[model samples]
Target: MSSNRNDLDRARAAWRWRGQQRPDFAVTPGPGQESVWDYPRPPAYVPDSRHVSVYAGDTLLADTHCAMRVLETGSPPTFYLPPESVDMAQLTPSDRRTFCEWKGRAEYFHVTDSSGRRIDNALWRYPDAFDDAAPIAGWFACYPSQLRCFVDGEAVRAQAGGYYGGWITDELVGPFKGEPGTGHW
Candidate 1:
């Protein structure tokens, strides 16, 4: 109980530092678009049936029709695919781990292609997700900038900062939070 309270306090402090208001420069959603600012806090995990694909240059690493997307306020969506759809041969477990107050501990993976080129800590997964984030258990998500990603046949662009692994697409409009000076979204 005390640990949970401490965790909640830390999360609240982080959010306070990141501010709560949407920036004025944030794009207004037009037809068929989503403004990231409209997303929910604590994030939402929802099923996405779109065909999602990942590639390391020309090597196809993952392709799946079943995926989950995490939508959080001020950030672009991060899509996660089931492990079965991914080429497990291409991934090597990394010692890196990160914590999320809403989820739990996240483990990272290093991706490598057939050509032997490697992207360190390019993938992440919450092996032990919190009850509310259980939907993402056993799923994996990658950094679009490290490996090419496509959603419904459209190529994805990586969100600005190296820390956040959100994939930016035409349907997502933003003056996104991961960019410079947005530490206080």
Candidate 2:
């Protein structure tokens, strides 16, 4: 592997929280709810059967029951929808890209509505995801901050920071990583 790749591996290994124990600051989950602190370090791809939908104003962008939720320690779940369930025609490939240690490289997309309103880098996908993240390859995940998102008929809230794509619903509890003073987490 290249030096850069080795450096990335080291960085990924340096995380303090690996989900073995929840910190005191983390909220205790209520009945029927989950704590993000209990999620694993490398993350888990859990198949979600709940209704998931995304919209830009009146234009429906994606709707699906087959979403893969990536649950990682200290962060809320990021839901990825199947390609067939998303309206690809409204998505234009963007030049932006990012890398995740467990998921590999991600390419972004810009969403355009019927009324010509465009949200740049609103969605992303891992075309050649690492083996552990292969289940979500070619699937799409949008930023709830940029577009309206819902799960099981409940309006989704965007994760605290502008960076994370986690869709927060009522069933999940967190002192989520993206919040202020969580940079080290």
Candidate No. with top lDDT: 2
TM-score for all predictions? 0.91, 0.96
Alpha-carbon lDDT, every model: 0.86, 0.91
Residue 142 CA displacement from its true place in model 1, Å: 0.3
- Per-residue alpha-carbon lDDT of model 1 for 72-160, expressed as tens digits? 88888999999999999999999998877777788999989988998899999999788889999879999998999999999999998
- Candidate 2: C-alpha lDDT: 0.91
Candidate 1 clashing pairs, residues 3+ apart or interchain: none
Q: Which segments of model 1 are wrong by more than 4 Å? A: 1-4, 16-23
Cα lDDT, model 1, residue 137 = 89
lDDT of 2 by residue, 1-185 (tens): 22277866886887889899999989999999999999998999999999999998779999999999999999889999999999999999999988888888899999999899999999999999889899999999989999999999999999988998998889999888898888748
